[model samples]
Target: MDPVDIGLWGVPLAILAGAIRVSTPFLFVSLGECLTERSGRINLGLEGTLIFGAMSGYAIAYETGSPFLGVAAAALAGVVFGLFHGWVCKFKGVNDIAIGIALMLLGTGLAFFFGKPYIQPVAPKLPSISLGGWSDVPQVQAALQVNVLFLFGAVLAVFLWWMFRATRVGLVIRVVGDSSDAARAMGLNADRVRLLSTAAGGAFAGIAGAYLSLYYPGSWNEGVSSGQGLMAVALVIFARWNPINCFWAALLFGGAGALGPALQSVGVSEGYYLFFAAPYVLTLGLLIATSSPERAMQGAPAELSITK
Candidate 1:
């Protein structure tokens, strides 16, 4: 009966809420992929990393009574997976993409095998801040309760942008990403840089998984992620590999992801289900529009596989 609940005017409100919730994982995953790609490596197995992190975070939170700790556990798990993937790809004749697919299967199989018992347990949800305190309506209050991780991600994006522009390490990453040979000429360790970047990226992906099970929707299930990890590849391209752009891009993708729910919340049920496909459709359209294999994206890393 709340005025803020499901009215025609509430369509924008529902979208705003849904975008914040759905975009968290996308934001993290895309950022992770952005980092890895900037290091000239591709990690398609992030899908597995995400699901595994979700399962790990949920199970740990259930046992430890701390959602934040669960988030840490998820990041740790993601690091392990990312490092393992990086390690394997370092070997001679190993294809990074192929190994990523294998790792995806491995992570998922492990999560499903181990996460079975934690499915029904109700873990404590992460704490959120009520930014809509001025509103008395329950829906408005719920809609404005922002998660801390999202804020963390926003700050991280800004920091990374600054790092890339000003810091020596950022310069090193950029140089290495642009040309491994140039990095070697400058006495930088290309493989090590890539491995570290890959691991760091995985850590971000892990946080995304944590956000999934410990917060919004708040559950550990096999179906918790709907290919958000894979979609991140396209998102990175859409954002042109800029960390700052990634933030806005994530919100856009999130809005697309929330399109169906937003429409449905306003009682426009017809064809709303199709709107669920909006993210994928948008990605496909972008890829098609930029379909020049010989040309690099405006800000794409020079050594990135896509650029090659």
Candidate 2:
């Protein structure tokens, strides 16, 4: 209750709050990428999908006064993008990576273009659940005001982990990722599996987009994503394609991302800007540590293009 105590705990408390907030998008996007990569494909275009979803969701929510509807629209848009990417990559000589890059550009460009009008409008915002009622400190209360989507993303990570380890659908996706030939021999359609996984992944990204516009910063803008969509791909690698690990990795990235602002909140302005780079630095470090050919191959799906 003391002012000194509040000052002492402010930075860490803010970081904790920021981690919960910032990490939600990362959690959703990374989990989506995890599902896609598990089926032997990657979606760098999720960056585009993310922004587009943000734009679309904001536009719809502004018009309809319903944030949930906006989220659904975003998910549908992501599905369309995913399907297009999947369809294009089905050609024998086509490269999924190249297509992903193109899609990323396409998605971003479209979002910026169509998003121009919605920038000034205020949309319905998502509600948060306060878990810090027992605490008398304002910082504790602020940090504990959790969003519904973050909880959903956490539940999703657990559900994905369970599905991959126990379900028949998961078995099919894994078999297809490991070896197309083996999948074909067992009478599974590898292309269909990958296509669906990619689509589902896009839906996840779209939902993340909605969360951005409807919650957190809670608005539409060109700079809303800040490359978090693309960065999530690296998060997927860091997590080694494990859904549960993806959840933890996202929180780490989130906390790192929150460091700069958290420092600034506590009057540490001298070098606080440098802390903003923590997430990117962590990404590079993780990639370097994990990129050994043997180590990469050990955790990556057999048919994943990066591993090859």
Candidate 1 Cα RMSD after full superposition onto the native fold (Å):
1.6
- Model 2, 1-308: lDDT tens per residue? 55335775788898899999999999999999999999999889999999999999999999999999999999999999999998888889888999999999999999999999999989999889999999887778879999999999999999999999999999999998889999999999899999999999999999999999999899999999989998998899888899999999999999999999998888889887789789989988988988887676567788888877
lDDT of each: 0.89, 0.92
Question: Per-prediction RMSD in angstroms?
Answer: 1.6, 1.5
Clashing pairs in 2: none
How do the predictions measure up, each by TM-score? 0.95, 0.97
Name the candidate that leads on TM-score: 2
Lowest summed lDDT over 10 consecutive residues: which window, candidate 2?
1-10
After the best TM-score superposition of candidate 1, give how far the Cα of residue 13 lies from its true spot, in angstroms: 1.2
Q: What is the alpha-carbon lDDT for the whole of candidate 2?
A: 0.92
lDDT of 1 by residue, 88-189 (tens): 877888888988899889989999999999998899989988899897888888788899999999999999889889999999999999999999999999
> Using alpha carbons, what is the TM-score of model 2?
0.97
Give model 1's TM-score versus the native structure.
Answer: 0.95
